[model samples]
Structures are given as C-alpha cells and as structure tokens.
Target: MPDMFCFQCEQTAGGTGCQGRAGVCGKKANTATLQDELTGALIGLARTAMNSTPTAETHKTVIEGLFTTITNVSFDDEAIECQIAKTEAAKQAMAPQCSSCASKCVRNDNYDMQNLWTDNEDIRSLKSLILFGIRGMAAYAYHALVLGYTDDEVNLFFYKALAAIGEELDADTLLALVMETGNVNLKCMELLDRANTETYGTPEPTKVTMNIEAGPFIVVSGHDLYDLHLLLEQTKGKGINIYTHGEMLPAHAYPALKAYPHLKGNFGTAWQNQQKEFDGLPAPVLFTTNCLMPVKQSYSDRIFTTEVVAYPEMVHIDEDKDFTPVINKALELGGYRELHPMTGINGGDTLTTGFARGTVLSVADKVIDAVKAGAIKHFFLVGGCDGARPGRNYYTDFVKQTPKDTIILTLACGKYRFNDLDLGEIGGLPRIMDMGQCNDAYSAIQVAIALAGAFECGVNELPLTLVLSWYEQKAVCILLSLLALGIKNIYLGPTLPAFVSPNILNVLVEKFGISPISTPEADLKKILG
Candidate 1:
C-alpha cells in the first residue's frame, strides 16, 4: 500500500489524492498513517459504544478525533498518537469484559481504515459523503462543546455515522444516511448558532479596521470564538492589543466579543495566506482551530496553537487554555515600530461583517419591498472556503460582474475575495452583506426561507442562487445540508472533490442539478439567464 492517501480537500494532489511520502497539505506520511489509525480507533470506540454505555467523554473524543483529521488542522504525529491512545483507553473502559474474554470475537476491534478506502466505488462515494460531512459537522459541534453546549441528537448521530462507515452498507442505504447527515447537520448548525448568539449576543453589523496599533498585540485566527473570548478577557488590562484573523473576523459582530476595548481589529486575509502574511511578523499568532498551515521558520516561534490545532515545536495551549506563553511572546515581540497599516486583497482599508440572519431579517420588510418594486432582481449566496487554488479568482470576478440590481449574501473565508468591493446598496442596504462565518450558512438559509415565505413560494423558487467555493470538509457538510433542504441549481468550484466517484457525481447532478462553476462571465450569464 502507499504511504499515505488523502483526498478529503478540494486541492488534493492532481485531483486524485495525495499518496506518497507527504500530502499536498504538508502532512507527512507517518502523520497521515497515525491519523488513519486514530480514525480506526475512533471507529472502534464508537462501535463499542453501540453495545455498551459510553460517557460524555466518548462523544467529545469522537468529535475531536474526527476534527483533528481535517485539512490544515494538526500535523503533529505525537499529538495524533496521543489521541489514538486516548481513544483506545476510552474503548477499554467501555468494554473491559470483551478484552478479557476467554473466547475472542472481532466485535471490539478497530476497523481497518484501508478497507473503506478500497471498497466498492459507489459504496465508498456514498460513505465518503457521510464521513466527510460528519467530520465537518464535528467542527461546529466542538465549538459549541467548548461553550458548554450539547445536543443529544447531534451527539448521537456521530456514533451512528461513524459506525455506518465501518459497516457493509449498500448505495441506497448509504445515500439515505448521507442525506440524513445533512439533515442532522442542519440541527447541529442551528445548535451552534444558538450557543454563539446566546453566549456572545447576536452579531450586529460592525466595521472592523485593518490597521495594527503600535504596541504589543496578538493575532488570533481560526473559528473558536470561546478561545478568542477567553484571550480577550485575559488580555483586557495588560496593554496588549488583540486582532482577529481568518474565520475569527466575524467575532467582531457579536456584542459580548466586540465589547473588548483591547480587541482592536482584523489583522490579515483568509487562512491560505497565513504563511506569507505571518512571515517575520512582529507579533505572535494564536490559532484556536483549523486552517493552520505548516510552520515556516521565519515566524515559527510566533505560532501558538490551542484546542485541536497543533504543529511540531509550536507552543500549544493545553486544557487550561492558559495563554500566558502567547501573551508573553507578544510582550517580547513588542509589535510594530509605529502605527502599521494593512489593507484587504482589494486594497480596501476597512471590512464590514455581522450581517447575520437577525440583522438581515430585521430589515426583511424593506428587502421584501425592494423585491416587489423590482429594485432587487436576483439574490446570490456566494460563500464557502477559500484556498490557494488559482481558479478561486472566479469568485472575485463572478461577484464583480453581478448586476447592480442584485444582492449578494456571502459568508465564510471565501468572502475575502470580493468583500472589500463596494457593491452599492438597494433599499438602503449594501448590495453585498456578510453573514458571519461558515457556520453562519444557517443564517443564509434562514434569509432564503424567510424570503420564500414572504413570497408564498418554496425556497427553491426564490431568486437566490448559491455559488460556492469549497476547500475543506466544512463545505462538504454545508453542501449536504443544502441538498437535504431540496435547494437546487447550486454552483460549486474551483474544483470538485476528488473522492466523488463518477456514479455518485451522476447521482448528485441528476437529483439536485448541481453544476460545476465555469468562467465568471459564463457562469454569471447562465445564472442570470
């Protein structure tokens, strides 16, 4: 067998998979093997949980283990191995009698991951959708878990789906579970939405600056708002400033989070540019979650990882979540010499976020009036993950070419493409509205459903067109949610998943009318027409 095989992300090597000494994401072969082993152990734990009673720790460990294997999350073999040991221990505690039995059965053994990889193509495709979709959902679940929120339905589905991956299932059964993954993920996203809004307050439209104040400051990235909130609270009176990066940008929208006087502003662009953006930076960068690129020597010492994100030689904040190392590093770095300024990819000095469902629906009457008055002709939900792919420019161009009478609702890191562009407004609202982070795709769905309700039509009949760019499994789950909701005519790009078999692609196309994005002009013309 090859040393490694990973094609979970959109940029998998040569559009097949990365099977060699290293993955395209810089994950080494040994690290990949350990991840597979960790996955196998997680399967065993979940399999054992089917026949025995498991604790809250079992669900949390399964969520963390699935999330750890996500792209750009962790590349530390030691950490992955540690996670494996923990999974084994969890399994042992759950079914100790099975291990000490005089007659051994294969009921409690870890599922060999390679078996699924080499399974029948259609079965693999359907199961991959379920597996990858849950992997993405676990991220949202993990974030909620940290905020002291738990949903039994969502947690229970984790076992069902993980166990299903290890079973001999047919296409019809697996496909149903695949769509159910989407259905359950919708609830999971809603659960997370409630957790975030209740804890941090509903996000309001907030303008975040791009300038770095002259002093000791730290740039916090990734999707974990709880970590950012804790860091913001701890650094409040210390004279150290805080700036958000990547998916953390939407933290500015939440009332409780933005109230931090020292929570200065945004620092950089999307996650893919971190290596270049953080090269030789004066301040330290703390990652609370995924999208952590390989550490570069230029600023290796400045990277501090917490939660599931880990890398070799980086200072990892443990369960205590004590950020003293990161804080002291910021003190040592002392930040910039003067007021250092930065701009977005579009050279805009400021970025606006927090146009979540609550905020947008607050103006629903005006939006409805605009549509009735023919002032807003169409709506485009252009959002998803951003990456280093060259074809991602299609999103920027597609957004730029949108007609003036249309409205664009975007979320997630993909908005960094054209968010800074002033798309103008209709009925006293900006044409382009950011609806929080990727998890906020729920907000977009809400807005669409509201519009459909206002017009007495189905969501599929609304003027909204979903043009998505996916880079990771989070996008996978979101896509499944949309498909499960029966929304159609969605456009996905820059490239489709390498794990999708030809028959499965045929199924998605025939059932949902899923389209691969072409050129911006061509796609825009087709979508408009």
Candidate 2:
C-alpha cells in the first residue's frame, strides 16, 4: 500500500531517494515494484547458476535483467514481468533438484529488495554500490553483446555480484566486492571498446551540423550503432534523411557509418530536452537505449523504441530491425517545410566530435609540445550525463570559466550543455573536444594513461583534472573504475549520491580526495591556482 523507494539517480526526490508514487524519472510505483520483482528474480537465477555451469543464455539473461532495471531504461511493467518469468525459468532449468528438496534451507532464493533497502546504513550503501555498479556495467555489456562480443569473466562476475547482494556479508567483504565491481567494469568497458572499434572502425575527428535538412526524416537517439546501421541501410534511397540525437551524435564519426549518404545531421540537443525538441516535429524519433524520458502526448505518436527501451503503448521495433513502421511514420510526418534551422543549447549551428583516444593520441606529440611551450596550461575532462537539475549549469559555467589555455574534453549528454560554444582552438585542436559517448570514457582513460606515460608521471600527477556529473548508473561504474585505478582528486556534482552513507562518504573523501563541486568560480580557482 506504501509507495516504492528509489533514489538511484540525481533527480531523486529532494536530493534524497525517491519514496513516493512515482520516480522523478516518471516511473510509476507499479513499474518500480515490477522492476524490483525482476531484480529479485534475477538474483534467484544467479544463485542457482552459481552452483551450475552458466551457459551463454544464462549470461544473456543476467545482462538483460540488470539492464532492464537501470533508471530510465524501461517503463513497461509487462516487459519487466516478462524478464522476471525468463529469470525464473532459467533458475528452474539450471537447478531443478532444488525445487524438490525436502529440506527448507532456502539456499538459493529470490532476495527481497526490501532487505537491502532496509539494511544497516553502511551495508546498504556498500551493497547499493555493487548493485548499481553492475546495473550500469550490464548496459555496456549488452551493447557489446549485440555487436558480437562478450567476456567470460565479466559474465560470470554478474552472477557472483548478484549472489553477493543476497548474502549477509560483512562490511569489509561487501566493500571488497564493491571495488571488484569497479575493477571488473573496467574490463567490461575495455571489451566494449574493442567491440565498438572493431565493428565500426576507430572514430575519426569530424564536424556535425546541428541543422536538420528539409524533407521527411527520422531522428535516432541513444548509443546503439548497430541499430543505427540497420536503420540507415533500410532507409537508404528512400527519400528519408536520418539524423543523430543524444549520445548517437558520435555515430557520425565512425567511418563506416558516416559513409551513409543520407545519414544527415544531428536533430536535437541532449536526451533531457527530447520532449521539447521532438514536440510536434514532423519526424519519428527512435530510441535505441537508455536516457529516454517519459514521452509527452505532443510527441507520443512520433516515438518509436527498440532494444531494451520501452514505454507503455508506444510502438517497439523488435530485434528483426524492420523499421518500416518508423519509416512510414517519418514519411507521414513529412518533416519541416523549408530548410529548418536548429541550433544547440549554446546557439551554435554545428558541433564537433570523434576526439576519441585514438584521434587524440594520434596528435600526442603536438599536444605535449604545446604543453611544454606553455601554449596549453592544463586539461579538464569535464563530462558525464546531463540532467534536468538546475545545478547542472555548473558544468556550463565551469567550461565557460576555464582559461583559454586549457583544453576541455567532454563526452556523454553533458557535453550538450556547452558543445556548441566556440572555445577556439589550441595547437589545431579545439579547446573543447567532444569525446563520443559516456562509454568513450574508455577513450578518455586511455588518453590519460598515454599522457601519463608520455610525461613519465602518474595520472594524478599530470596537469589534468576530472570534473564529472552523475545522473545514472553508468556514471556510477565509471567513477568506480577511476577510483579502482587510484585516480583521485576528482570533482563530482551536482550533488553527492543520496545512497552513499555518511561514513562511506567520509571514507571516499579521506581516501580518494573526492569533493562535491562548489561554484564554478571557486572550483576553477582551486584547480587552476
């Protein structure tokens, strides 16, 4: 009879966890309960698979189940219920003997999320880290899997991590697992990087216009390139233009994808602005992954979702990838009449991307020379997800206040806040470099390691700072990976996670020097001083 509890995102109620009729992400209480049931069932399946050998199907189930519960991924109770059924079926097949056991030991059973939700504060915080971290990592893994890649270690760890969540482990034990989640996520991210680069050639630097061309068009959002590829192939020569939106903006940098003649330009800003950007647009928007906000009535008819993304009553494109319905919708809408001019949040008409690790490191000698010559004083990796919170403007102000002599590398939706601002260039490199999507944090990490190697110093010793904004689980896992690598002095905002207990927060501050962001002026002064 009471409302469900959820605070896994920055938009949680009042800077605390959301404990109300619906999540700030627009997830209803019934949907939240179904997601919890799906999670619990996945845990039960993991417990069963811990004793039995896991099949590829087992790993796939674990990945999809976790990904389904990620904030903003799914809002359909039926889809989550279907996942729960599949999880239960997998458990039954894996350990049929347990069902008939006379003893009621309950060795492997579904974990009531309420237990972890109501556990001791510290334990809850630690377990939440492992759970949320895996949920985020699962998204990356799912993407890679769709592209024909998977790591056995990463897959098995999902079972181990889920089982640990159901255990009454001590603080130290859970803490170790929490850190292990981060360490494993780094490997998972690496696997995804390889999958992406190998599938679509290493991204090259390219400029993307924000203007949407006239005529019928479909806007593709989210991070799945394979889906984009299929859609492009299907729509080729159909008089329909395709444009990237949200995290898909970087898809234009892929040599294979960019070659598509009709894959026009980007349509909208970040994912948070979709409702406003897509409203009454004479085009269909296809969501291939997370960061989908609740659809509004104004644009509901033009919305189509594929893969794990779902909303009640919206048309879903299945794995077959037949996008005819979407194409038809686009044709029906017929797009803008004249050449419709669209600008980014910064009022700029174009954005540049593809500054991934490969591209950046290719010009490493020039960058090092510039730094040595005092042409470039510092580097700031100011990137993460963008949210509806007003404090998120801090990222905009931080980049605006950064000295011209510094380079700001950004990724994910957060870059939308200032991607269009002309920060000028340093040594032929734009002062503000867009680094693909959030998973391209892999690219950023690679660049950092290379720079440290070039300077013969540790990453922390380099004249570089990481100021990140968190909104969802992917940010959680990425932060853990940084901490796991002993990278410190990171500034995080708009606020600390509500799930972090006070003692755990102290440990993070004392051990890692993690600091919540202050005013852009003060933080910039502290960093640049």
Local accuracy by lDDT, each model? 0.92, 0.92
| TM-scores of the candidates in the order shown | 0.99, 0.99
Residue 298 CA displacement from its true place in model 2, Å: 1.3
Please, what are the lDDT tens digits per residue for candidate 1 over residues 325-437? Answer: 99999999999989999988888878999999999999999999999999999999999999998889899999999999999999999999988888788978999899989
RMSD for each of the candidates:
1.0, 0.9
Judge candidate 2 at residue 54 and give its lDDT: 78
In candidate 1 the C-alpha lDDT for residue 314 amounts to 92
Instruction: List clashing residue pairs in candidate 1.
Output: none
Candidate 2 lDDT, 174-208, residue by residue in tens: 88888899899999999988998898899999999
True lDDT of residue 510, candidate 1: 98
